[model samples]
Target: MNNNLQLYNTLSRSKEKFEPLNPPNVGMYVCGPTVYGDAHLGHARPAITFDIVFRYLMHLDYKVRYVRNITDVGHLENDADEGEDKIAKKARLEELEPMEVVKHFTDRYHKNMDQLNVLHPSIEPTASGHIIEQIELIKSILDNGYAYESEGSVYFDVKKYSNDYDYGKLSGRKLDDLLENTRTLTGQQEKKNSYDFALWKKTDPKHLMHWPSPWSEGYPGWHLECSAMGAKYLGETFDIHGGGMDLLFPHHESEIAQSNACRGHDPVHYWMHNNMITIDGQKMGKSLNNFITLDEFFSGKHKALDKAYSPMTIRFFILQAHYRSTVDFSNEALHAAEKGMQKLFNTVELIDKLTPSSNSSVDVQHFKDSLYAAMDDDFNTPIAIAQLFELSKIVNQVNDGKETLTASDILFIQNLYSVFVFEILGLISENIKGNDDQLVDQLMGAILSLRQDAKQNKDWATADKIRDELGKINIKVKDTKEGAVWNIE
Candidate 1:
């Protein structure tokens, strides 16, 4: 197996060679979406980012049990831990049950992810389904004396946990800084320290989502579900844990503390985080109210979009940048990505049509090696994409008869494009409707045949009329030595 894979470990603040605890057995857990609304562009980053990691690991012949949880139970509004549960609030507003709201948005999230071609995780556990596990985890933490109950709510003693283990190791936050900078929320009176987070939040009588726990009738905290579910599925210690960079501070930090307090050890070996997406140099998030939903991008229904962008265009745009770098959103950038994606797909389509020569002009092995090298370096997809573009150039050159490729070279290039472009990158050609495409082909063939007859008879006016009619529909027709070619604009 290839052992040169290196990834950025947020825990250590450095890039380290990936050495799994057990060879060919990798366990990874990424924080999944909190399903309260339509998933926006900001949500796609971590999904695609960890997806690349998941794909590459499996490609390397690793048995990866990837776990991504659906937040159906306990995530609060604004991460404040005081407001109503996000799903419950939505449910109340929509006049539906809490689980009904969860089902609606969870289905929407899955649909959007499917459109993006992201693979479904091996295990997708919901917090509501694992309430027993979460309560057990909280019990373990309490037994370790890292948590305490006050006013029917259990809060993690960040001050006490910090005394035994470094509380802010993952996010590089100090306990002093957190204590000083922590905002005053409504429920601050119940905790000993301002920075101490809730393990279980006691719900009010009107709160829709509540369960019977040792502390009170309440739900688990946002951070506790991930810690509990991950440990329950991936064991106390796993290979990797990942989420957005924004989650590094209290969410992941608290996870680290809770896992240590419960199991007497760290939960994850490598910690990874993907940066956020921005719009106009400002973070594009639902809280910002400037975010565009994935559905809006696909349908071009928003006021900001000039045209609908295909799912592959969005995926390619995200992959064009390193996962750790911020991807700024703009219509112009997306349009450029659409063109580039189309060009790459066109080259791949042309590959099968090219006739082989006696000699090869491109070094196929060197190209493949460079692609793998880019992926090996922290899954540097932008560098890998650049390599693919170079290979596309070679394919174009050979197709245009400007260069040459032997039969072996043709097969290697085909396989290379198949694996990287389709499998790893998760890009696929957009499917045109079969009946519509066939109808257009038949009509174009008939029209061109009539034009040929008209030109043969020196009927220039008739041929010009046919060409002008097609042009009006945004279809450009070009005459080549082989025949006439056309494309829809």
Candidate 2:
């Protein structure tokens, strides 16, 4: 509901103040994983990017209904209209049901998102579950003379639709250039033009997934699902549509065309896209055989990674850069992020223990305003994070007795960190835990007390056995003048 909030709209190619169609109500649709394989670094960027948008809008008191669709079907192997469906191909290769493949990968995808602290969408509709809706959308397009059926398949009249409406406004592609450069591929003979895309594709004998449709026994096209599901869940037009920049060309552009063809108008008010995560100056993707999966990063199982990085580190690394900027992956960058995250957490802890004074040494309102200004200007998380770092320096000064804060200022600082760091940025402290870790620490203290008793009684054998047993499990016990302390090695 904040009128000052601005977002970079890919359609307009500029930052614009976000105004929802309805007051205090926002509808956002983001393109989600295809679930044909393990989620990779490429998948994490957009998820985290939109998670920021989702969190900030809700923080602004907007009743946000975020719809992120799961593409369980109709996403082809080559991202084209003719190739095998990605999930179906995985199923065929693994000798399992297509839905089973979808469930397996989708579960892993969800687990990874949860580890990254990404919030779940309000509604997650699947393409397979919404087959009927896609069929009806195709029917509407055909009725409106924007699509045609050929040899039991339906193709969107892209060349024809371009004449009536702007075809590539989202992607900025020209129809004549597309037609001239678009190479002829297999299974395109039925189309009137080479650039025309499918609304529905006729299933071949070997095609593993299909449903009965009016045109033929087929499945929805790759671009048809988002158009159908976005309109179904968020009305004919919604506030924001988001995805990775790589999808801007064919996937999202076709989505715009499909929506316009059927609904006779634009579907989304704002189009937003997050840039890619690159490795060795190349975009990370599964097809390139150079991408690393989230599992590999967490476990340090990939050859490219120097060591294991926590989920928060990965999330921090992505957020350290603007959502629209390409983030190149490197171990040094991740290590820096890990250190930066720990410093922020340490500052929060220090702020909690700070004693208040009768007078404040700093203007806490300036800090708040700076943070808000960064977010309002296109969700600039890096700048907001910089402000947090500056606040960390101030907190260090107060803790060291070089500065002071009033009781009200201290309370304000606490609430500010809680709202921005935990709620909006979705960062959780790795070293800090809830009651579970407290209980573990207490139990460990009792065990250490028993070892101390053994040492006091001069039972060298028992003390050595206890210490050795603990060592076998990767716990190192250090004895100093203060006392014996144990840590996980």
Candidate 3:
């Protein structure tokens, strides 16, 4: 029992039906990292959030072409072109080349995403590689009178664009309000108006990432990369464009302006944004420096974490709250997620061990229908997970032989687990150790024999090493349960 899905649209600020541009086919784009530093927990938001979207669309039998870009160039430290490129700044700080810094951090980003089990996108183009496309977009905008060149730099004429179209449709802010409250600095002597944004910025002689353009020997503006790269790979119009809610302001907003100005149409059909991950109600961000990297959190290397959480637990925690809701990280919250994940997986594991009866104790029809309804309503994962718990209760009762399921019902339960939990939501049991106790028993008996032999010869070093190695593999071997025995740690 499957139903068509609905999701929140950031442009309209409402939950809407997820209608792809092409029937049974979709093109998706999400803004990727600047790759200047380690990937923190905050960086995992859009990656996992949109990954769920990508996975679910494929489950629906839609041919989805997902294109997430690698922003190897042209992200300014501050909002203005006068500021340094973030990658260039990191390179100078670490005494490395700009591309070297990007590669190093991008590798780390991929590793972290892999740990969280995110599927790689179909096309991942880089900003630096798409310079010709970006230049063409700038030239088109200039010819259309939406952009103008002054000295060596080109700026978008916001005031001129506003005359023809609603410049603030996505963020829902008036152009005059944006112009009024916009931060002004000493760099505006060349801009036609304070609201104008850079299209191509003139680079200083010291800049490492500069490229030759018609206006000057400069890099593309920060927003130009996404507009150019997304259009090149996904075309002038795509099905879905997603990013963190923080990008809704100037970043995504600017992309809308530059791409629409050049192409004469909106780039994305449906816009999705995942809300922020907050730490005690304050946003965990790079500029704020309140972030703990994903590696640090997993290893419990950060001073704030009480213990390391498994990657699956982290995935489940984010899913418990809807993507659009801000999930605050706390020791209590994480502990609850860990407990729930273990409980849920344990139930799924026990399903195969259960035997069915003539009649079922639980109402399978009602349970399945409610679950499908929850998912249909804007992908309400929280409610779907709650239904999973209901299934868990039935499974436990049936395992206790107080309740029963038919053979066909058991197969239905397994199918639901595979399709909805694993494929649709991208949540799977990552526990490499099999659930069977006998496997652990055979391994532990062999290991303890080695320990005993080492102990008999007074080779305490060898015995301790054996124990330490077993501990690393999550097996706790003890010297007495009559003799040394082990349990899963």
Clashing pairs in 3: none
Please identify model 3 stretches exceeding 4 Å from their true place: 1-3, 79-82, 435-441, 445-473, 476-487
Q: Which of 2 and 3 is the better model by TM-score? A: 2
Q: Over 4 Å off in model 2, which ranges?
A: 79-82, 432-434, 437-439, 443-489
lDDT for position 192 in model 3: 86
Question: How do all the candidates rank in terms of lDDT, highest first?
Answer: 2, 1, 3
Q: How do the residues 98-185 of candidate 3 rate in per-residue lDDT, one tens digit apiece? A: 9999889889999999989999999988899999998999999999999999879999999898887778889988887877786656
Candidate scoring better on TM-score of 1 and 2: 1
Candidates' C-alpha lDDT: 0.89, 0.90, 0.84
Full candidate order by TM-score, most accurate first = 1, 2, 3
Itemize residue pairs with steric clashes in candidate 1: none
Candidate 1 residues 37-128, lDDT tens each? 89999999999999999999998899999999998884567754556777787788889999988898999999999999999999999999
Error of 1 at 410 (Å): 1.3
Q: Model 3, clash count? A: 0
The estimated TM-scores of all candidates read 0.95, 0.91, 0.90
CA shift of 471, model 2, Å: 10
Q: How do the residues 1-489 of candidate 2 rate in per-residue lDDT, one tens digit apiece?
A: 446899999998999999999978999999999888999999999999999999999999999999999988845566544567777777878999999999999999999999999999999999899999999999999999999999988999998898899998988898889888876576679999998888888998778899999989988888988998999989999999999999998999999899888878999999999999999989999878789999999999999999998999999999999999999999999999998998898788778788899998888779999999999999999999999999989888888889999888888989999999999999998763333688768877888899999999999899888889989986778785558876663
